[model samples]
Target: MADTQTMPVALVTGAGRGIGRSVASRLSAAGYRVALTARSVEDLAGTAAECPGETLVLPGDITDPAFVDQLYADIEAAWGAVSVLVANAGAGVSASVVRTTDEEWQRMLDLNLTAPFRCLRRALPAMVERRHGRVVVIASVAAKIGEPYISAYTASKHGVLGLVRSAAAEVATKGVTVNAVCPGYVDTPMTDATVRGIVEKTGRSEQEARSALASKQPIGRLITRDEVADAVLLCVTNGAITGQGINVDGGAVPS
Candidate 1:
């Protein structure tokens, strides 16, 4: 058996809830000393409580470059350089290209694309030096295809997917692997918000709106948080799975 103190260290961003929380718990169960981060201290505390193994909770806004730098520094100070990074914190906004305000467009790019890029930049050098690391970005099916009223969100996800592919290629010679997990309409608070928006805009009942979203997946259900976490763990453990976006979308956007 391996020493608990020598367990691999994993840092999961946006870990307060949803897929991030599930990923953190899953990694902890897999014997990783997981570090959890998000903007909400209460939420991070809740996630840390659910983790079965050791956890370090750090709360902050990952979109801020300074915070991203400090986040990596703090994690390194606590548990050396992270051997696994799950960049799962992101937000989506629905608007037609014409209706999307500059602020909203930038928000999507900042939180979903640029923030992950910053985290990757900060984490990759140490990982390359160690020649042992895994990076999984929690992207969306939006990254793989175009959809109405979500142009900005799609653009951001697509950009992050490109980032993952490029980074994976750059570090393939090293022992590091970079991948993205693309989930579709996950049953999380984020999807709850999307359902609420549909109800408000289309006058659909809550159940009807939810079913409509679920029907988008051929499986007729929103993807589960645990399912997405499973994909992340696969990327973490499989050295040959680099530069791939494993879809947990129930066959929604088959590529």
Candidate 2:
């Protein structure tokens, strides 16, 4: 068994809650030294508390390039180059193509696409040089199939998946692996927010809104956070699974 000093280091963005929090805790329990970052200090602390292994809490906006750069530097200064990176920081905006404003479109792109791109770029050099790394971005089923009222979110997710595929190919010869975990509507706070939107727009009861989302999945239920984390773990352990978008969407989009 690897000692604490020799355990791999993992950095998880948007580690405050939802899938990010679950992934961070899962990595920690898997014997990784995790670094948690999000906009909320309290939430980061909450995630850190659940981690049985060592943890570093770094709270900041990943959409800011400066913050992304500094977090990598701080991680290196503390635990060394990141052996695993989960770019799970992202936001979804519900809007039609015509109704989507410039600000909303840009925000989706910045958080979902650009932020992951920046993190992937920063992590590659050290990983390639050391010839060891794993990168998994938490994307969505919207990336594969388009649905109504989410033009910006779908586009951004599509872009991130593309980024993952291209980056994985570039680092394939090296020991580093890059992949994306595309899940359907997960039972998370983010999904709760989406339900609220449905309530406001369609006058559907909160339960109805949630059930509608669940019905979209052929499994007739929402995907759990742990399920998504399992996919990330698969990517980390299997070196041959790079450049693929592993769907945890309960057979929603058959590939």
Q: Can you list the residue pairs that collide in candidate 2?
A: none
Clashing pairs in 1: none
lDDT of each: 0.93, 0.94
**Model 2, runs deviating above 4 Å:** none
Candidate 2 lDDT over residue span 102-181, tens digit each: 99999999999999999999999999999999999999988888999999999999999999999998999999999999
TM-score of each: 0.98, 0.98
Give the per-residue lDDT digits (tens) of candidate 1, residues 7-97: 8999999999999999999999999999999999999999999999889988989998998889888888888889999999999888889
